[model samples]
Target chain A: MKKIISVLLAAAMAFALAACGGAQSSAPASSAPAASSAAPGQSSSVAAYATSLDDIKVKGELVIGLDDTFAPMGFRDENGDLVGFDIDLATAVCEVLGVKPVFQPIDWDAKELELSTGKIDCIWNGMSITPEREQSMSLSNAYLNNKIIIMTNKGVTIASKDDLANYNLGTQADSSALEVVKGDPIYDSIKDKLTEYKTYDQVIMDMQAGRIDAMIVDEVLGQYKNTQLGNVFEVAPVDFGEDLYAIGLRKSDTELTDAINAAMKTCIDSGTAAEISTKWFGSDIMVK
Target chain B: MNLSYIATLMPALMQGLAQTLKLFALTLIFSLPLGLVFTLGSISRVPPLRWVSRIYIWIFRGTPLMLQLFFIYYGLPFMGLTFDRFPAAVLTFVLNYAAYFAEIYRAGIQSIDRGQHEAAKTLGFTPWQTMRYIIIPQTVSRVIPPVCNETITLVKDTALVTAIGVGELLKAAQGAVNRDVNITAYAVAALIYLAITFVMTMAYERLERYFSRHQKKEG
Candidate 1:
């Protein structure tokens, strides 16, 4: 009887495990389309917006959404206070526009949703200006020149894009670096070997473990993290493409977009942008 | 509603489901036996063994699995112990689930009547024999239901692997959603989760029936 019970329990556990496994493997095929059919209209409702420059002036504060973990651009400092290049730039821009800057840390993935829903007046982190973004929201003229660069372990020899085919690369998911890698035709052959991480920090961790051979990241971020880590990694010569950083707002907010553009130009002409850049990057790398 | 759009997403989601299944299977395979060990240790008469088991269960069950994953994957490397993405995820899940399973095993084992042990001893069975042949066998039928619950929960919990960026089903769906600017992929992911749970429910029902057959005949 005892033998029967033990066998029964083992069998039952196996069966239960297999049950979930089988279900998961088979579920999406029959039900996914049905569920997705009802999603388009519901999600569309989340995209409507009406905030403008007048609204911001009357409100007397600009709520700027950013991923606070993004170093140098917008991240927490040693004292746990929010400070970064973009944070300073946004504060100065707010000053010119006669409003206070209220930094709102947000999930980087949902920045677009946060802006569309008015949870934030603008996304002012190291936000890259892509064509898709240009269609989705009002974007300021590019204020910072960024490029996708590959960073490999110091000992690894990556001379160019061709050398990357032999390596397992990683990049932050939903990031411009990932987009650039995916968009590059040269990566077509080895794209299968690439991994996407939630953050550059994770990619760096994986790189340290030798689990990944290289990571594609922005020059600004790559330089900042490498410097902070005492230059444990080296940059590869492969260039993906130019990525320009800009402020993102609701598409209807053209007036606010123009206002921010003017404010940005004022900051650059007054050398405030250069000062903030030098403070963070050790040199003025702003797009004047 | 777009058939072609979903069709395009199917391949990506399926790839993610494969990773999810692998994580679930590996977690169950390792955690179940380890959980049994912890249970035995918890019930042991040895003072240190019992305390160690108790503390292990307390820490694992008390904390969130997500934080545990972060600590193991990202935190431990600072102390010079780094794990690859998949291993880190599996290690965290196995350790966390083992604690919960240990408690369930402990309850099931303790519920067995003392008379059963005495009866086995009267038959010249050693203490180990009594547990192996008499106590554990009965405990199995009793713990199957809860163990089944945990197994199903593991399926959904595999989604948490996305935090460290090991693209499982939900993450794949999320990626599709972000890329396409549509929430339809999320809806599909939900349906996929529900379908898996439904199948798990049916499988458990069959197992329950099989386990209770003898009791039914006696009743």
Candidate 2:
């Protein structure tokens, strides 16, 4: 009987992985286009703009879209298990909302389309707030604080933002860091030296290999990478200003926007958010 | 480069390789026969059948495989059609490869001497018999080398499945790199891919020699 139970558990995990986050009761974080009890076409086509709390309740699950490759946020761990700060926080929020949280891994580039088309009800990843995002999507109130900071290989010194002019710099294209840097006067000083990669991982890799002298990245991801790589790089003395992380929902889903924000408030008030945050990041990083 | 870190990654890498091998094997099984059907369609006397096959070949072959994957997996959902991740990936790969295979088979068919057809006709054999006995067998041997090239390309193309969020060998390696913040996993992945292709190439060479042996003896 024990052997059978273990086999069943294994089967469930494999199904969760294969279905791309199908509803596996055990691992609340299932993988991609989960055939949710919600009738896909009926929900999107018939209602059009009525993705309210009731509709999600009828479906009985919150289909969250995320880029699974993002570490320290919604990424897989060393054991190939999906566990991160956002994943745990979302799970807590889902418990409060009384629905299972189904994590659907998505192409990060197409996240907005995924939201607009009703494929996923929300983008619950560690997405940062930017002017364009605020303009395009209905967003929750700030849940966590982050900063876009410059980091450099240990031997490379950058005493200030201007000191970056002496070194080769890199940041992810289309990332909030790039947005912040571009808007800063210092951007002009480092424009010739700046290179943009598709992901921070590549920048980290290049820095470890000694090709890039410095890279601009967010606090959670950059610090996580530094810790994992055994402090290959140190935070440069200068950084872009503070940034906030929030949940992204479709513009018409104002009802869900309010519901999620309320649930988040509940999670914060009860100290559950702090507990989960501490578990992942070693402290309460959630904005009180 | 920690030997221990790569050891820790083995289970996940093996799982990813299983997904890649499944996609590669299923694509070949479906596309090879599907290509023959398309080859027959393109050569049909009816213009509609020939045009349909030609256009399909043109569209699937001319467009990028990654685009087709996105269209089927993500794009089609908006239109009320949805597929699971693995099937969507397999569907895209099979259609894309079949088109390429169809063209290769068509070329092989056309390359046969017209004199052989005339000889088969003179011997009272029907056109169907001529194609079945005289054309296809010879074409199979002729197309093996090109087909092997496509197979090797298909092995690498499995990496594109990651775009649609399906885990495969390359994604596994990238996952490890992100988790460990190290590049050693990538070097190990490259070596594993090289090992797979090396085995596949040697197998294809053996199959090729077996198919073309008679021609070699004559030469």
* lDDT of candidates 1 onward, in order: 0.78, 0.82
Q: Give lDDT tens digits, candidate 1, residues A66-184.
A: 76656778765433366789999999999999999998766565465455445688889898876667766788999998898989998888887888989999998778887777777
Q: Pairs clashing in candidate 2?
A: A20-A31, A20-A32, A21-A30, A21-A31, A21-A32
TM-scores for all candidates: the values are 0.52, 0.87
> Which regions of candidate 2 deviate over 4 angstroms?
A1-50
Per-residue lDDT of candidate 2, residues B1-219 (tens digit): 778877898887888899999999999999999999899998987755776687678668876787677777766665577788899999999999999999999999989999999999999999999999999999988899899899999999999988777889888888777777777778988998899989999998999899899999999
How does candidate 2 fare on TM-score?
0.87
Mind listing the fnat for each candidate? 0.00, 0.41
Pairs that clash in candidate 1 = A37-B1
Query: lDDT per residue, candidate 2, A90-161, as tens digits?
Result: 999989999999998786766665676567899988888887777667899999988888888888888988
Q: Which stretches of candidate 1 lie over 4 Å from their true place?
A: A1-48, B1-219
- In terms of lDDT, which candidate is strongest? 2
Best by TM-score: 2
**Ten contiguous residues minimizing lDDT sum, candidate 1 chain B:** B174-183
lDDT of 2 at B40: 90
DockQ of 1: 0.03
